[model samples]
Target: MDTSPKIVASVVYGCCPTGEPTVPVHLPGRHGGPNRGELQTVNTYPAVPATAGFFTIPAHADYRASAATVAHTRSLSFLKPLMGGPCFDLEAIWDEHTRYEFADRSVEETMATMVDEPYVNHVPTLTGGIGRAKLTSFCRDHFIFSNPDDTALELVSRTVGIDRVVDWLYDHARQTK
Candidate 1:
């Protein structure tokens, strides 16, 4: 199978059953949503089978059913942790083909130095609900090298509260060996 990021996915944070988005207090160190709000323009909309809950802008809205979200999950409340590191900078992996890092160098400097996608800023422009830091960490820890596309699925899980499903998939992947 081919492992490539054919899509772009965003995971939103701070929402409840009815979809009330709040800013996370001292949100984790990662970069997405409000933490870097000044650098982005988010576009949002929702269409539901009621069960598919709600979904937001995805990384690769370029794909079919890419906006698809699992039913009955949709809760931004799950991401109450990770106001720290690791998962915070995970979005940086989105541009697998590019070379950028949040090291001692400024993100602006990195974005400006991008020799690949001249359109790419070291800072990614994202759209979606807020994302959970723990979930964000989990995705980076596991899929960083495999199918970063899994991050897309993870984002879907975060939007709704289907993290258990994500956990199951990861666990099953381990046990199958």
Candidate 2:
């Protein structure tokens, strides 16, 4: 018989600084074990209101010497020279675009962040179009205006290069008919 503690899924929680609350996290156990693919609710933190699902780390009013701050300062010092020339932060731009998308903003407002002509292709459905006019029409008709109210996006990772950024994300939405 195996006496060792079975390695379970790792769960990461983003917490608020104010209080340590119990948060329930669902974990799907591994297959073919004694706990055979069972859904388990692990109460981790103190209970927080359902509406307060997300938390932000509070910033200090005054600068303090911490390991993280020190590392950040050093990183900035190193990056300052490399980023000195006129450069655009693609991450910020992508974040703004994501916000606009989830908020279901106007197609014109969303397109403002893109080039004069842009193309989008939803490979699975083959639903997107090319050029500003067609893309704008597609967004207005099928995506921006028609997205569900509870639509959300989970950004897994982003790789920003000299001229392009590739983002891996999960789109969460409810189908409405």
Local accuracy by lDDT, each model: 0.29, 0.54
Give candidate 1's whole-model lDDT: 0.29
Error of 2 at 136 (Å): 0.7
Best by TM-score: 2
Clashing pairs in 2: 21-45, 21-46, 22-45, 22-46, 22-47, 23-45
TM-score of 1: 0.17
Compared with the true structure, what per-residue lDDT tens digits does model 2 show for residues 16-90? 222232322232112221321232233322233323333222353322234233333333433444446346787
- Cα displacement (angstroms), candidate 2, residue 137, comes to 0.3
Off by over 4 Å in 2: 1-86, 173-177
Model 1: per-residue lDDT, tens digit, 54-171? 2333443322243334311232222324222112222343332122221222344433433333331112433212234433333334323333322232222221132321221121
Candidate 1 backbone overlaps, count: 18
